[model samples]
Target: MRPPAQNPPTPQTPDPATAAGAPEPRTSPDTPDAHEPPDGEEAQVIVVGAGPAGASTAVHLARAGVDVLLLEKSRFPRDKVCGDGLTPRGVHQLLRMGVDIDGPGWMRSRGMRWVCAGRQVTIDWPDLGRYPDFGLTRSRHDFDDILARHAEASGARLRLGVKATGPVTDRAGRITGVTATGPDGRPVTYRAPLVVAAEGASARTAIAMGLERDPRRALATAARRYYRSPELSKDEYLELWADLRCARTGRDLPGYGWIFPLGDGRVNVGLGALPHRDHGTIDLRATLDQWLARLPRHWGLNEQNADSPLRSAALPMGFNRHPQYSRGLLLVGDSAGMISPWSGEGIAQAMEAAEVAAEAVVLALTRPDGPRRDQALQRYPAEIRRRWGRYYRLGNTAGDLVFSRFGYRPILNGQVMSRPGLLASLARLLTHLMEDPPRDTADHVLNTLVKAVPLRGR
Candidate 1:
């Protein structure tokens, strides 16, 4: 669906009559008025972190005329450790945000080329008519900056170099605001009615809220570098190299190395594996070197065009299984452990979740007072779980099967390779069968199945 217009009229403020028993608003040292009454005061939604999830939430909320306070620990144009790959779904989200991603300095992809067991398979993306099927690849340094700018332009107040230290609560234990450290190292507090936590991986907010962490699987280390390679084509097809026998551990780490070609004679290459199989055992830099060395002779990566320093980070794979939403707070992006279990992809999921959360927040603040206010907040978690729970569970299952070298090969060689249709079916199931804004029936079924499945040893 297309994004709504920029900044719709503010929803009716919460009725003062209904909020009579609510605690008086406490102004913070950083705000204009700290001791004003909360009733009739504009409801401000605070979004922590300026990554995809936070930016999208701020943009959507601001567009809905909700006063949004976006806080980021880092400055703009900063680099985030990522594969720099954006799927079609991600591009769609950006488009909805009113950002034009198809310009110079971006690499557009048409589809994917899979190289496994010495066999090659190519899958074409589903057609979107005039719109390209796949996505664009750009460094997060530039990508996140663009999104932050868009959010600011849409009227969201962005506070960079501000880190949320902890939550502010009332006597009732409901969160009322956040305490943060400003760039100058001074402690500052931002008071808001609701907080959206989008902090990546290490979710400080989630922890402060007493939510326990339960990650399903951990990905092996990954390293990436960009090289100046003119021989690489810019058609948007991602290349994956899978060599089962060449792994350091005999368990056959079911991971593949990727070389994504950016249009400007530069290619992004990286490799990932399961945690127990190859963590700290292999020299990822040397492994990338070996892979790069072999690429010139066989694949398209020529030695003459390599440029840029190698980068590396650990990817959080599988479902984090953490409750994504709670009273007075909601989590998105990597903070909520939304990364894909099979592919370790999170940008699309993050953006999608941000939109859903923004909508829920709007509803929660605008509805006529009563138990519905609490119900509105409940909708965000319920909707998110309903939509993504099944796909993530399936991804966890797929990760287990693929990471086990012995198990993955046969599946890759026989089922995935021979049939092609099997992989296609899986892809379709993930994209279509699972719900987005999921129905109650589907949610119940998925919740039951995910809990029923055992996490360890198959």
Candidate 2:
């Protein structure tokens, strides 16, 4: 079956109804393939998807004077199911992209509040000297649309309502561009020197390029819904619950629950679960129904208060895909399975990968086509693996133990969470927010554990 497009490897259409002053859908019933790839202008790189990762890549590349084109099947102000919480790492990426976070509709978070085993402790985000001291939260419907405009403002050409069907390749099998349909449903082929698949969880053209998800890696699922919560909507702390037990087995499922306040009279509430051998896949929607009933009545979150229906999506965790860069095509975000097995965080990693890929693309564009360019392209995956391989490998194993029904353990039990001092250190460790060179014992200990796991990819 074909995968759905988060943003097709083309531009997302601007809804005249939704996006004020937005351009009309670049289509002509009289014209074939709408305008064709590149339409009227030429492009050096073509990006699939207008999500965080893809849009970020375009922003960076456009700033470097590279001609980048974004293809998306949907229109602006589209809704994407997400936790809508940004960690310090994600905040850093947004700042790097020059997003105006001080504006309205943005909520600042001081820290994460962990509720486990009837004990709750708030752990402030670490000042690791690499990321910001605070994080921000905005719904993806606004967030994605904002980022798409940011990319366009950076000089990237966007073609709206175009769905990238597959990769266009050379005889030797390197992707040169993408095959897509216009808003009017006519097929068009876009050609460029390099291609990027930032199409969220669905691999899309990357799959056409011979990349398959690695079954050995951890794959997770998440269900989330928005709720109108007058009391907790403005909360500064993102709340998490770790004491969730399965309704059927009463066993600790290997996943955590989250309540991320959006500060707009609503909060994004959800739970994510890892598969277990004994129970296999758990029913997340049903689990969510059970979970909502358990929330404090003071928070004002319940079925009647739900702002949106419960929606579930897959989280391809732990670098589940191989050769993130290959044969002139690069994968970013969910397409590359950049979600952390440790925290189920993907946006920060995806934006970081977009930056890394942009840097590599800029350098490769400096060289003419052929082996030299391909060599530069190789750095994309290599550097990605270098940065994340060890952490993911370790997290994958840890996740297995945490979620496995036979060996399920509450890593954040009362014993560990009750002690604020210890939980503070553990929080830093779990979030991987430590400076290199071993700033302290916590960093050293955490680094040692991460390094002990043999990395999977080269």
Candidate 3:
């Protein structure tokens, strides 16, 4: 998932930690007109938070000749607690953003290795013309920096060390911009015609705009720590352990654990759980410690080799937040709760939503501020929900059933893992990697089934 707002360590060595903020900016009572901003003082779009969603949005908007302001609470080369695994879907987004994946520091992955119920299987990424048939892993410290710099180079005005406090609204309660606390610890106000909330799962700006998260939706918590594991560092497959159990109750967790090799003597070890309403309390940190202890000693995952502290954050699943576009404010990335429920992946969704939101904004800006512009802006959420709604609904149902009592074991037993065809199908389904018109019979059937599902609350 996208890392929550946190300050990282020195650029040379990235470390993840929580964040701090200051008071809101005060508006002048006798300023010029309320409608007009000072000369050269406003942007066409204000993007809060510089993670994948914000960076992607700013990059696309700048490429389209839109003046964008990208604000971040942290500087470049900062660490964001993440699994660091980029699937083919995410890779496609990076490639579209012109990121050099073949360059140094990018660890390529061949496929995925599943370990559960005393069964193991390796499934390679599908070979499809629509997507690159490979995955990659790079720490968020480097990953986010690359994206932010890329966006800046594309002409987006990126402001680091600036924390957005809240949205600045007009008399009608429509958001005009955001007031922030700059590096000087003083309040500053930035105005824009449109504001994008890419501020991760905390969703500060969206909440301020009165777009609350839907409590009926599923929410997951994830904890991750880095380790120096030479043995696994060069592995081509992204390893997933599905046999995780709760530390307190011995119940199966509703999520999976991952070991993503970074090809640099380091591996990101983490687990995420999408707990249902009745799902009891499970300590993610203790569960992570328990799982790591069971790994082979030769892997060197002990505390002595730990590269980072145990950092944990919430993964808001599905479209947990509503009305993605509200009163000139748009939600993207974790702010809209766009993380995948089945896979616990946020980068791909964030970037994809950024692209969609950028296009919508561009279209909206083409028209005057009226019903037509509002209609164009409203299409953003509808389009996003149309693309991912049914799939996530299916995932939520499966997670509820599969992560329950003896839920995961039966599915992962040798009986199901033995068949390569079935395993590959399962992989494609879980990762949401498929092309239209179908690559094969499996993809055809899968796409048909997903499309046939009755959609609700579009």
Candidate 4:
């Protein structure tokens, strides 16, 4: 008989001093007591938000020797409501950023398994033969702190407890900097040649800058919790439960429920739904509990196990169809709706966008008054669209279909599970297509498939 599963780690309250390695909170250069710059001064780039996207961008840019100022509305080690599941791409990006996620506390993962309608299927992520696994799991609280610390170490100046109130624009209507409210409640002005908006779903910065998102495209709410379950210790697969009939609606929403094991017997379990008034209104906690009640006996969870209080938030889906960059400004991650409409996964996309934006910012700074700046800024939105547009659009359409009453069954059995090879092929195609200056025959085939995929009505 198999040995009893190991108990997962208990959820602990976050301690910034211990986690972030800083005793005193860092202050922004715009703080009241900040040293005055000699008459004329400017920051090369100012990134708003200190979450994954913002911190990632700042780190990348600062590593390139560019002066970057990063502002966060909250202090470090703050909790971010999210699913907390990092895909292979997110892992790859973190490595590229010089983050050592596998050190001691991280929970590694290998693949994802889908369980729905009494059927189960698993997809093994492509192994380049070097990496240990496909992904890992960690709370946003610890993850964000790690990223922010990395940014600071790389030369980016981080300012916690500071909020950007509004953008500063030049006479030509181009963004010049931002006016922020510091922890002391005083308004301070920071001048930067370019600004990156990495704030999450609220998109306060983007909206303030006149970017409009299509409402219909925005669908999906998410709730999550960290649970101590001895049953998850040996479970390597990131499990997704697709049946929502167990909940109040008697019908599943466009999205599915997920259980991402964080190793050490802990797991991050959450549920998300595409926008439906009735479905959205359903009590998420009740639904989650209903699902949790049915877990297999071996997958250990009990009343005695310590579990963190549930956290919930809205997920902006179908928001990637539009350009996210404008003159003197760029948006990355959820601010730009970079979350995959199909998977509701944004961490990897956020990091990728951060890298892309960092490259553009570095190039733009070298030619402040030249056409190169304009060209660099212009390339950002277009490049992002080209890179993920087709897949994202298709994902939205697929999400719509999966959530609909009539379309769910066929998608589950016919497209996703029955044809695993097709799914693998698509994944490979997408990976190939996203490479710069697309390859030869593979690029042609991938482009054709992308075009052939129906993206209109579900």
Question: Which candidate ranks first by lDDT, i.e. highest?
Answer: 3
lDDT per residue as tens, model 4, 318-339 = 5542346664678898888887
Q: Give TM-scores for every candidate, taking all chains together and pairing residue i with residue i.
A: 0.79, 0.89, 0.90, 0.82
Candidate 1, 1-458: lDDT as tens digits: 21222212223334221243432223222223454322211236889999999999999999998888899999999988777887677888888888877667888887666677667676655554333477788878888999999999998989899888876654334556677887777777666667898887767876776554564465545678777666674646877666633345444445667778877767787776654443336566666676677655634554555566777776654546355655467888888777776566788888989999999988887863335765787777778766665556666666666553432355457447666656544433433333333344444454455556544421
Note the residue pairs that clash in candidate 4: 8-264, 8-265, 8-266, 231-299, 231-300
Better of 1 and 3 by lDDT: 3
The candidate that achieves the highest TM-score relative to the unseen native structure: 3
Residue 422's lDDT within candidate 4 is 52
TM-score of 4: 0.82
**Worst lDDT 10-window in candidate 1:** 1-10
In order, the Cα lDDT scores of the candidates are: 0.67, 0.79, 0.82, 0.69
Q: How far off is residue 44 in model 3, in Å?
A: 0.4
* Model 4 local distance difference test score: 0.69
What digit string (tens of lDDT, one per residue) describes model 2 on residues 240-347? Answer: 887777666666666888999999999999988887665666777777778878777877787788889889899988888767776678899999888988888888
The candidate, 1 or 2, that scores higher on lDDT is 2
Error of 4 at 316 (Å): 2.0
